[model samples]
Target chain A: MDTLRKTRWLLVMLTLAACKKPTENIKIVIDTDVIKYTALINVTDGQNGSPAPAATTIAITGTAANDIFELSGKKDIKLSSGIVTIGLRPTVAPTTNQPITVTAEINAPGYNRETRQVTFRAETKQQVINIQLTKTGSTAPPVVTPPPPVFNNVSLTFTGRCPNRTDLEIRPSVYVYFKKSDSNAAFQYLGYMDKGNISTNLLEQGGTYDFQIVYGAETYKVSQKIDQTSYNLTLDMPAACNF
Target chain B: MYFRRSIVLLLAILLRCYQVNAQNNNQPPSLLGQKSILLNVGTQGVGAEFAYGVLPNLALRGGLNFIPFKAHNVFKISGFNSTSNLSADFYNVHALADYVPVKTASWFRLVGGFAYFFKAKGDIRVIPSDDYKYGDLVLTEDQIGYVDLNVNWKGLAPYLGVAFANTFPRNKFNVSFDLGTYYLNKPKADITGTGLLEGNSSQTPQFQSNIKDYRWLPIVQINFSYKL
Candidate 1:
């Protein structure tokens, strides 16, 4: 009876030992995003920051093997052993709103290196600076046309004033255009429209030869060359909607 | 010597119980000079069932065979980051003959036979969905929907169940209440996804069934049968 009891105890001990469970291995994954032409610098487990790819290479076309964004100031980053991985993302691609893909690799000295693609997008200014690449699309000063010879010596109480209420000197704009080449060569400067005299000037010796107005933002050129008589010059303001 | 004597005494007591029940439990051997034929009739799923005196120690059980299951009520899924509330309806049915080897007065009845499970799919919710990426939340009143489900048998299951029937002769009619457990291995059940649960149950949107791990279904049974 004693031997039988001893044998049962031995069997129970063996069963308990076999039932001790083992530890399970777990896997971890992390994701993030960035833009082009910019650097995403993340501080390592150490005091220093490291670039996402560890180094910059041009072959980073897609998110396959070795595609990572470059960081200008991160090189001597020291990461700890427990620090599994670090991810970096740029603000946006060079010109478009599409964000660049970031593939992260953590290579510590004595530990196994970890790698994964951190996908994300960066915010970008949607509207482009479509302003003229040059003078072709510039919004600067306008052009003027030479007036025809006023040989008629015609001057009768000439009355005119700059309609522009403000900034008449700095970014001044005129309102008239000559339809023909025989129009006036120079435009008389009537003082400020609001404060200048409105009552007429003393009648000069000759009658006035009316030419097109020249003070607005209109461009004018000689359309016709008739030398004999003082033909009236046509003044046309661009449609109000064009401004 | 001790075990042998105990068995002999137990057998003697059982024989007396059987003889007394045979003489006193059933109808007094009909003076009409006629005997009712003992027939065992069972149902396919749900109805009435009974047992009759066929011989000395055996009885034939028959009735409206009815084996029904509770419709699935609550459906839930735990995703990577969130959990969701879902709903499903399910059912079960059984039809077979029970052979009881013990005497008429024996209280325990062990019976094993065949059963069928019919499942009908209802309606699907979460429409116009091509992808399946959703967070988990409790089921709201708005997320509840109904669809008609049809249950049909894909195969048959041989099952086992037990019934305890007590008899009383008040008006020459036999009535009994059955409390039993039926086992179905794997029956065909059509499950339809409706409301919030519709999008996650299919293969295309997400590769997961709405409800998993409820293979063995336990249910409650109440039966009524009359001897002819």
Candidate 2:
């Protein structure tokens, strides 16, 4: 009788063990990166260096105009807060000897019309074009400021963070802009950050600054104090979190 | 198909051993003080064990097992024609107690044990098999890149199951079969990529969720024992 009872217990244990299926719920997710070659077009008020008037419009011309589209893959490109990201269509790309070029024309009701040449080279996937518009007839050539004073080289590695997704991190490949934290001066162009890393001598020790990047018609900003030679900074980039 | 055939063969051998042992109705000798060394192979890989009889109906065994395996194109992603390379490494040390309950069926035993897994990890890298094109440009492999999924389950685990034969050798030599499973520690999973696929890190959350419950490692082994 004891042997029979033990057999039954063994069978029950085996049955329970067999009920667990470990791989049944496993799922694999794959995401794609579409827009590879892009250019950021930034337009600002030439007088105070503020964002262009709310009504400013952008148009693409030249032979390659038809091959260009907004970062969102829309052909009807317009400036949002005076910034827009334009890219070559997924079916179009530049070759080593043949670079793709387009003319971006900016227009505002009270500002002079301006056009900038945007080029997409095979070697460089990202570029930034800055356009400053001056009010009609009040012409002093657009302010050309002297180079920033040389300072200690500071390396900033910017990581883009997704607000809703804590596990995801983004290494942004885009142009950066910076301004002194206490100054009202417009954000000045910082060099392009290649895969989240950039080293520049424009920052001074014991100073605080705000860094910004404009993408998909939105501007994301992060602030840091330049007390160290190397720092890792994070920005809330909702636009880059679509994946 | 090979695994199914192996299980069938093992069951046939177990039945033969039972028939031979049942022909003699005399009570089996006490196992106390008996010792044996065993070599085994099965789902958990090859291993060597040392077994000692500690009580009339119980024996204690300690052993080590390890398996390092690699394969290609074993994993697939739907809608993505990619080639995957998979590798797994598992090494562990375990101590178990085998208990016999009924005198008439001394051949049957229940096993309970604990194992410390020193190394348990699996990695798979998926690379695009075709010529990848970005826009109109054909990209090199370095630019197209690959995604790697890694999971590690390295910790203490508890084991339970049954054996179909006696734990100690009956005479000079004997064979036995063990069927069991180990409940491993929760696994940690992550995904990483290079080049254009670098954005795949965003999928780490989903990968972790999918692999959270993968803690069961089953064993089906045959042991060849020699009395020492």
Candidate 3:
């Protein structure tokens, strides 16, 4: 009887040693986009092609105003650094025959209030509307400057990181803007980034630049030196982490 | 169906053994220089082995085994309706030593061995079952894709078990049972996704951690041996 007990104990120990804890690390990651049809409104000073003044505000009006919302799903639309992304409500969408149209009114101190018609069509999911505002008393023609010099192609891959989720990474698809790091110039329109990758010939070598993107009513910025032909940049986008 | 057929064959062999009378005398049979060939089926699948008695109470055996299986919709994720495909393949070659310590009970033997698994892999792919929609827009299959989880445990593994019945047949043939477990190497796991689900590759580390300890492969086999 004693020998049998000892044998049973040994077997139990061996079994326990061979055993492992159950799976606790497999997590289902579900990512879904709510607002599909979007329009990016960029407000600029008509005289010198700079961003609108700090106090500029945007208001949506017209028949489809009720269906319009900020990319963050808020009814109130405000500009951050003279840019705001607006989208139709998740439950509403435009049809092929009956497209949705709304008027975006921009108000800034000392500059003439400007309004632009924004339209959402069934075939287009994303569109950018540029609105230039002139001073109320100025009748002079708007200044037109030559475009920036084009240089060797520079490739950038942006990775969005979540502050709270270490395991989650985001590949954002949106428009990009950039300016020299040391300059106070308003960000110029770069090309659209498709799934976090973009190649452009606008950046000069040995120059440092700040890249920016606006998504979900929030702005994310990253800076990099342009010594190399390719770079991997990381941006903290807490707004895009709503999974 | 194959597993069912193997069980039926094992039962028929057990019945045949019952009909044959047991040896009346209890003197342990001389096993030196004796050899046999065995065919087996169990949790490890079908296999063939050769056994040689090298000592009075000990024998050495060598063999190979393989199993390939595939199924559909066996794995699922909570709150997500998806169709899944699961496949598993395992193949190994092994050598073992069987030692009988009790002269009075030669029918029971302690078995220890090591096996080198040339191929041990499992894969599961899950795809969204329904037509996915983004807001009010319907998406095509290419716009919304699938996720695959893979794991491999291919390496040398040590085995421990016990065998019941004589190593060699009293007559020309005999049937025996073996129960054992193989301590396989730590598994490596990964995840890959295509299209919109491509970001799921970030979850590979967590998936590897979850399956790191799943290294024990259990075996329960019935062996039919014919003496040479």
Candidate 4:
């Protein structure tokens, strides 16, 4: 009995001595947005709301043209799937009297040139620009795609996942698309996702949809059923897309 | 100061009791032999000691003690969404003297000791949970990082307490309780953070200030002894 007691005491002491510090493997993280003013420019065929023709280029012209830049900080902006995000440099701020104004000149090989004015207000940090281009000398009136079927309003919250860094997440600001998971149809534009959140009446309740987003040549996809009115979805992006 | 005054009063009473008992009867068998060993467990940790009777009323002891413990989710900081983990380790080696004055009641004695704690440390880390978000982007674990807070008080400490029961058992077994405190040396603290959290190191001074006055460690322990 005495020896047993002694052994127990020794075991207790050894157990305590082997304890490791809690914070030894812990870490904290923070992310920041340096681009304060952003706008998404989506160009489409006027007839069917389909993607614009290839080799589309966008030009900025105005007093504040020098301050315009792609959301990725590039001065040369191009369209991807009829979409591009442009923003004012972090250093520029628009005021009531000095509201920044710029003109977007979009040109494609088979479509008539189109120009639209883009204005930046101080309070609104994000905006969307939808440009519908008319085909040169086409006689048929523009065709409008039928609206998506709706059951109940649904809100989707998107989170961007980084492939290389498991601990980092991104709230993406990009256009979103959806299609029936079992169908052969191409993905159709749903709406814009602002900072990873969007609410729409397009998702029918009890229907399964495959969601997709194209950024920098990569199209990421996630599938979910619209059983509930809301969903938190994840879109995995490559390491190069981390910003 | 209160502990010192109490110790003086206790010694006086025990000495008076011993003197009276000695005048009425010859000295009984010595309370302990020339050598004895003890195994103890207490609030401070677990330890073993070897004791030698230096006089009929006093004995000298030497021993070592150690404690290791880890606590999870013990800390939370405001304005930061994080999970905190805490751990502590204390180890010491010491020499002490036990003075028994009451001839008839040898179980009660006064103890004073000095210990050198070669390993006394506490650590806390704050890790951001997976739910953490900045704007609309969820951060990866590496980009988010973590912060660590470390404090150490590894040096000499003085201990004082009362030991109840004999230092050496009458037969092969003995049990005793010790109530005392160790005044540890001043503590030095530091903070470090990784990745985006590296900025947390600036709070080290504030943490140090909050813990500057925490230098006293109380001990309540039980010892089992055997005569050698």
The prediction achieving the highest DockQ against the true structure is 3
What are the per-model numbers of colliding residue pairs?
Answer: 32, 0, 0, 20
lDDT of 3 by residue, B1-228 (tens): 554685698677655553442352257776688899999876676799999999999999999998776667767765566898877777999998989888767777899999999998888898989876543345566666789999898999999999878888887888988889888889888988886677678788878886777777877788999999
Docking class of 3: incorrect
lDDT of 1 by residue, B194-219 (tens): 54333222222111121212132332
The worst-scoring run of ten residues by lDDT in candidate 1 chain B lies at B205-214
The candidate 2 chain B region of ten consecutive residues with least summed lDDT is: B132-141
- Identify the runs in model 2 with alpha carbons over 4 angstroms from their true place: A1-36, A71-76, A123-126, A165-167, B1-121, B124-146, B151-164, B167-175, B179-191, B199-228
List the candidates' TM-scores in order.
Answer: 0.29, 0.63, 0.64, 0.50
Ranking by DockQ: 3, 2, 4, 1
Per-residue alpha-carbon lDDT of candidate 1 for residues A102-174, written as tens digits (9 for 90 to 100): 5545444332344444443345311111010112334444332233333333211112212331101011121
lDDT of 3 at A209: 97
lDDT of 4 by residue, B1-228 (tens): 554684586567546544554454453547445678898887667899998988888899999998776666657664455787877788999999998878676767899999999998878888876554332334457766788988898999998988876666556665667778788887787788775566556557766665666677777677878888
**Candidate 4 — which residues are off by over 4 angstroms?**
A1-33, A146-150, A182-195, A214-218, A239-243, B1-228
Q: What is the docking quality class of candidate 2?
A: incorrect
TM-score of 1: 0.29
**Per-residue lDDT value at B183 in model 1:** 39
- lDDT value, candidate 4, whole model: 0.72
For TM-score, candidate 1 versus 2, the one ahead is 2
What's model 2's lDDT at B22?
82
Residue B173's lDDT in candidate 1: 39
